[model samples]
Target: MPDIVEQHGVPVLVCEADGVSIGTVQDALDHLIGAAFTGAEVVAVPSPRLDDRFFDLSTGLAGDILQKFANYRLRLVVIGDIGRHLAASSALPDLVREANRGQDIWFLPDLDALADRLGPDGAGRKTG
Candidate 1:
């Protein structure tokens, strides 16, 4: 299992190679709920750790997850380069662009950027 760390006071979840699957995502969610996720300003999901199988930017799974984050008013940070995703789907760039437009969702490679987005600098930017 990938260890969970707190970066700049925000919760950052690193995905283990074996944990990058639908089943393991539940565990990640559980870990978040059990941790400081309730009041967490930012929840960073490192791209390398995510199960690419279900993270298709144009697919329902990704949409569902984003919807849930919005419903909960949670800021979700996807940390990493998404060149692969951009190559896979022609719609991915737009999808990512739209997702990032929302305060709750962001796509970036830097963990510190995630912290800033979820910190005092990006406060009160809830979707719900």
Candidate 2:
């Protein structure tokens, strides 16, 4: 099970590094449910949990999965290094840059970044 903790008063479900990898849309939904059950407003998934296909813009898997999170009204933060995947795709860098600029989803480098995004009062940048 993932750990549930509060960051600046916001509930966050931090996915374990050794947990099941998310290679499909179903996998993303499963995690969303996990967040809901934990009463988490945000789900922080480790980079290893994401399959390589998620980083491949051509696969469309990332969009499908992230949509589930947004539709469920939960925030998602993919934590870790995606430098290699970014190097392989032309459009992914743009996507990451755009996502980080938004609230519902973010591609952050670490947990500290997550805290910063959550902000001092947990309202984040744009609010939910």
Candidate 3:
């Protein structure tokens, strides 16, 4: 189950911390759409539910998943400590850094970090 919470005044669908990794792009899409249906402007997914391949740029899984979210004009936030993956691969750290710098997608250390990024008013205003 997921939680629909107001973060920084924005509605965000926060995925469960369950350790079930998303194995395919379809699964990712399902989650995104489901979140959107709940009127969430941003979908916050815990890192524990992401497949290991998602952390490997060469697999292209991350790109595919991100594209789907972008196509729907939904913001995707991957939260949790991905330090192990980052240390294992140089590209992953770079990718996370780049994503965090953008508004469309972000990879944050935790929910608090996300709240900080969203600021005092969340992502400016609420969205459907």
Tens digits of per-residue lDDT for model 1 on 7-103?
Answer: 5565555444343444243544564323425455556666765657546754466666656666655566777888887888877788778867676
Which prediction has the highest TM-score against the true structure?
A: 2
| TM-score to native of every candidate shown | 0.66, 0.92, 0.88
User: Candidate 2 — which pairs collide?
Assistant: none
Q: Candidate 3, residue 79: CA error in Å?
A: 0.9
Q: Order the numbered candidates by lDDT, best leading.
A: 2, 3, 1
Instruction: Give one digit per residue, the lDDT tens place, for model 3 in 41-116.
Output: 8888889889989998899999999888888878888899888899999899888887777787888889887787
The predicted structure with the larger TM-score, 1 or 2, is: 2
User: Model 2, residue 82: displacement in angstroms?
Assistant: 0.4
The list of candidate 3 runs beyond 4 A from truth reads 121-128
Ordered from best to worst TM-score, the candidate numbers read 2, 3, 1
Off by over 4 Å in 1: 1-28, 31-38, 116-128
Candidate number with the higher lDDT (2 or 3) = 2
Residue 28 in model 2: lDDT: 82
Clashes of 1: 0
